[model samples]
Target: MIERLSIIGVGLIGGSLARALRAVGQVGEVVGCGRSGPNLEKAVELGVIDRFTHDPGEAVVGADVVFLAVPLGAMRGALSAIKDRLDASAVITDGGSVKGSVVADAVAAFGKVPTRLVPGHPIAGTECSGVEASFAELYRNRRVILTPLSETEPDALSLVSRMWEACGAEVTTMSVGHHDEVLAATSHLPHMLAFGLVDALARMRENDEIFRYAAGGFRDFTRIASSSPVMWRDICIANREALSAMLARFGIEMTDLAESIRRADGDHLLEIFERAKAARDRYVDRVK
Candidate 1:
């Protein structure tokens, strides 16, 4: 159990983690730190945290664990802010979608990667933002991937893994490279496609009517397009190498599919549809 926990960004992911730990009685004194004062006030009012601070350095004081839930773009600044104030033995982890950039940021900010710092990403969330959207059950039955470097302290990794497990998440560990490649294909690529499809349709003629007539399929596929653009922009840039490779392969496949459709190749279209349906059907239940 943790005595004091500091969360650098008290948004959906951070606030939800706080609530989850509170729900299990595994944590005490959650101090939320964020750029938005009003949002921090709201988190306090909602009982997501015991107190609030606008400064990351002040928030980490006396805390045994620090969780950085800020956007990928804000991570370096947050780390730099808390660098000198970090307790020598405090375990630090993050909810960044891209692990490589976070590891690099830690190295840059601290002169080297701290053995107590474990990079983690919880594979769960809605297309929502802010502390108000947080819930304790957000991570229930979800996977939380922890990427530990060779120098990472075993005790520190154990603390982080057990903390996530207490929050109802299945904790798993993998190399940072493997984690980034897999997430780029599974999560980032889908969000990119969803955003691209929605933006493309929005720019078409009679876009208003197009949206007005859009059905369940359109909404379901594009739901993630409603996610925070700033966060996604950073994610794309941070994981650009892996994400770009996936995007290139997808682009080639789309071009071939379009050409086949333009040629009125019903057989080709049927084959593609059948293959996709079979694949999705096999894995859709796992997602659900």
Candidate 2:
């Protein structure tokens, strides 16, 4: 029942949400705001939103719902700018990958308005950004994680959940801490690995040769490496504690693999490879 919605940052997630919301008739009006004048103009031209602005305060002034889709590091700054002007009854949510930090920052910036804040992460994206990259089906069949604190109003939480559900997403509730921890393993760690592997390979003496000889496998493996550097950098720093734990666990498993390879333990290596293959196969089967 959100009559007026404002989407801040108008990047891949925000733009996609705007497009999906319109397609699903989830809101009466959708407005987009971002720091980039050209991007806001593009969003308006793309018909993703009814209007666009560069002012956060003006964007959320009368909105019934507001989504902060900026990078995690920019969350605080954006919230601070719009804090005073946001509708008291508006359900303020965000698309930030990291939740704990964002929740804390938003609460600190907005004071008692924390009750209106609902932290969420839509487990959907592409290696794309800006209004031009957005599609109405970007969130179709995707899982949307809603991290609502005890202080969060039930009506606000329900509104946010229903909005995402109408956008073709499956909504589920989770704690902000648990959401951050799980994402650190599933999404954040994989991105880090992709970035590191690509960087290490590109810096080698045979870098150009490797690129010339690369096939679909290598290309697919490094495809996410091309994602926005600023966004990934912010996510890495924002969730460093959880990411560090995941990295340490991965390192231990990697060390065991290396030890088996060094010892030429073919049987153990085969078992490990088989298990991994089976695990992936199981996931594929489930998806199908």
Name the best candidate (by lDDT).
Answer: 1
Task: Estimate TM-scores for all models.
Answer: 0.98, 0.97
lDDT of 1: 0.96
10 residues in a row with least lDDT, candidate 2: 104-113
Q: Which stretches of candidate 1 lie over 4 Å from their true place?
A: none
Candidate 1, 62-176: lDDT as tens digits: 8999999999999999999999898888999999999999999999999998899999999999999999999999999999999999989999999999999999999999999
TM-score of 2: 0.97
Task: For candidate 2, give the lDDT.
Answer: 0.90
* Local accuracy of candidate 2 as per-residue lDDT tens digits, 70-179: 99889999999898898779889999999988987887797754888899999999998888999989989999999988898999999999999889999999888899
Q: Give the TM-score of candidate 1.
A: 0.98
Each candidate structure's count of clashing pairs: 0, 0
